[model samples]
Target: MLYKKKYSSWLHRINPALKLVLLMGGIIAVLFIHNVNVMIPLVAALAGMLLIGSGQPIGRVLLFMLPFLFVFVSTGSSMILFGKGETLWWQWGPAVISRESFYRGVHIGLRALSFGLIGLLFALTTRPVLLFYSLMQQFRLPPRYAYGFMASLRLLPLILEEFKTLQKAYKVRGVDSVKGWKGWWQKLRLYAIPLLAQSIRRAQRIAVAMEARRFNKSIQRTYYYRPGFSSEDGLMVICWVGIFAGAWIVGVQWPLFEITDVRFNE
Candidate 1:
């Protein structure tokens, strides 16, 4: 809900397409890292960047990430609860706990969190319309596909507002709210039909508008927003690379965990 069309952040100055590429490269780099010490500090550094680079309230970012707890927990718990190891700490029919598994579990959890933060960083700083625009201008993406995606993005808010309006209309007509799953299904059907019709009509109008505007893949067109590369992009690269290098150096010199490679077997 903390949607902003403009921010004075240094990160916002970087091109959206470049930001996506850097984030993808960072994720690939993270996958090769098996050291928990490196990942731990790297995660901390990313959180710090969210505070410094994003120029948004860190509290808002933290609030957005609250639900990710379930994701990382589920990700790490699987390895901890069932992985095989030499030193057995606990055993049941199928579930096993061991020293190696504990290390692996911690590693998996941190890795998942690392991936989540990468995605969060991109979503927090980048605007969807700008991203798609960059795709069209910089990446040479077809105009039809790019503009279609932009139109769909615009539709989301309209759908939500229409849904609220429908709810109020029903309430005024003395329609009671439902409690259980059956009642929920009925309510869903009630809204779904009208919403589907409205969406179809809106889509038809959008298609007509696009045709009038000549959004052809082969046709050359001008864009209102032109996201170009700049010095801020270079600075962002420097900052990210520095954080990753520093964390790796710290881990190698002073590792808190003895097991460096979670995959190695004795």
Candidate 2:
């Protein structure tokens, strides 16, 4: 399920504009936070919120996060091996490990996890239509762009279904035996050509329909659904501010670990 509706979740109840603000704010804060201790807890909190708002089982959420974990590990390992630092821990011909580099690597990995969890939370709980409506209503976004975006999202499932049908048809016609790298390339070309043509035809038809309805004729329009700020949005903002403040305070005062960025200048 790409975008499941969770009517009962608190995240769902909050306005989309507020959620968008939280998402962007969290990401920006995470970027400047270099301490692993602070990042780890932030990541955990975001993950917990995501799980709660997703209304999905813990097992499923963990399963969904496996790929992100893999990426985190890969990036961390690379940073640890290549990053430079003053306190040397291990050395080889070309690869060196240092205490600072190791900690930096861990921080990078935790940062990735924190960022990914924040994004996942937004993507899982928010609906495209709601976001569109909220943008147009609260932010005064142009209706033409908002409706076009909404239309594209609506067409996504159709495109996926068309691809699946094409795959099945090919299999039935005994042309699905392709394997290996070369065969994968061949299969991609085969699928890509038809999908491109289908998408173009669909886009043309949608454009005609929209134009017929005078979608772009006016900048002012009435919306059936209007989104507004609520108490929940206020609470969400407060909670996010507290989380960010607490993380920074603890990181600065307690000093579980220090974040050092080495820079050289002429």
Candidate 3:
């Protein structure tokens, strides 16, 4: 559902090259800012951009965020539980946890969330074909590789459909009840044989079609669509710069969200 809506929409109005630049700038800004309060503004800005650019519902946004939140929370908590620190908040003999460690974990989790949200905003709004063209034109990426990337993206849906049909056929042929870890391994190997064969066959057909069209011998090509930077792109760059500046000033000057430790002997 999300995939269909994303492609059929008018989000292609935004320039793919500009979007790549903005994502790079945002990532650089994220590297310096550690405080949740500082990060909140950045996330909010990206949220507004995604909402306006993609016209996706809040429900969709929340659904997209769910998996990333789970990943960060699980990984971050484990790190805190095993970390060593002086201000022990929880302890079971040598197995100790501290406030410092807990807060560090929280920081890591929120940072991950912020990065994930920003990236998702970009992915949801930008068409993969446009992204490929932008890379080829603006980033000077090799055209052959760009075309290959686009082909892979285009093939994914069809490939998944084929796999689904293959799975159904396998189930009907008395290959049922693959339940646990060992079952998963058995299923993968069983599926792998047919999948690999189908993939090779598909590749051969595609190569032949490309070769018949003289695809490789062509040095110059024409694009149906050309991407251009707009005023909105400038605004986005400025916003990213401002966030980094504010974060640096606030963090260095007043310490708005400081986490530090003091040692003592009693």
Candidate 4:
């Protein structure tokens, strides 16, 4: 469900490890930004990148972000309704709406939106297999865990299929359906035992296969996919730096919203 069919996006060319590091830095930087004016431009930059980098149409990308938008609204609205401020716009028993709170709410919303854009940018660009493989190659990650994780991802579909088959079998065999919590517990026991047994058997088989194939953590080995940095990496770095630089310049100079520091009202 999460997989993207297209691999031609420019973002795919960037090294996963480098891309991840840069992305983490960007997210951390975003957390420090408290100004709505700053966050607005930043979010715009991210949205632009998403549209351009993902090679997706504006409509499609916006459609993808609908859920995140809902999250932004919920979080921002909560802050606006409940946040404390001296300048009151509306008052209720527990809820208070003020100019400061509204600004803060917008700031929070923009932050959330920026996060969604960043996450989607990474997801849309990075392939799961490539990500794991890149981690193993670039970071010298212990092969035991890497290959195990890859194997598990590959087996997930089969495991799910088996679970469904087992469920159907239980129904065919006239398993009694109890009511309420007991039914839930009974279902758990009935389904869990067989699946656990199968999973253990599968694990044992995989272990044997790996040992037979001489897979181990020791000794250097060549990789089928070698993730390396390129001009594109530099370009990505420049773009990231450019976005923040532009955001800070525009936000400070123009000053879109009233509140500058969202952490505290001044």
lDDT top scorer? 1
lDDT of 3 by residue, 195-253 (tens): 87887788779877876776554367776667777777676667657756665565456
**Which tens-of-lDDT digit does each residue in 55-106 have in candidate 2?**
7667877878888898799879877888877789999877888887788888
Tally clashing residue pairs in candidate 1. Answer: 0
Cα lDDT tens digits for candidate 1, 56-116:
7778778877877778898889899888688889888898988889888988998888888
Give residue 195's lDDT in candidate 4 (0 to 100): 86
| 10 residues in a row with least lDDT, candidate 3 | 257-266
Q: Worst 10-residue stretch by lDDT in candidate 4?
A: 1-10
Q: Per-residue lDDT of 36-132 in model 4, one digit per residue for the tens? A: 8888888888988898888766687788988988989997998999986778899888889988888889888888888888989988888887887
Instruction: Quote model 2's TM-score.
Output: 0.87
Better of 1 and 3 by lDDT: 1
State in Å the error of residue 8, model 2. 2.3
RMSD of each: 2.6, 2.7, 3.9, 2.3
- Candidate 3 residue runs with Cα over 4 Å from true position: 1-12, 34-37, 48-54, 93-95, 176-181, 249-256, 260-266
lDDT-sorted candidate list, best first: 1, 4, 2, 3
Better of 2 and 4 by TM-score: 4
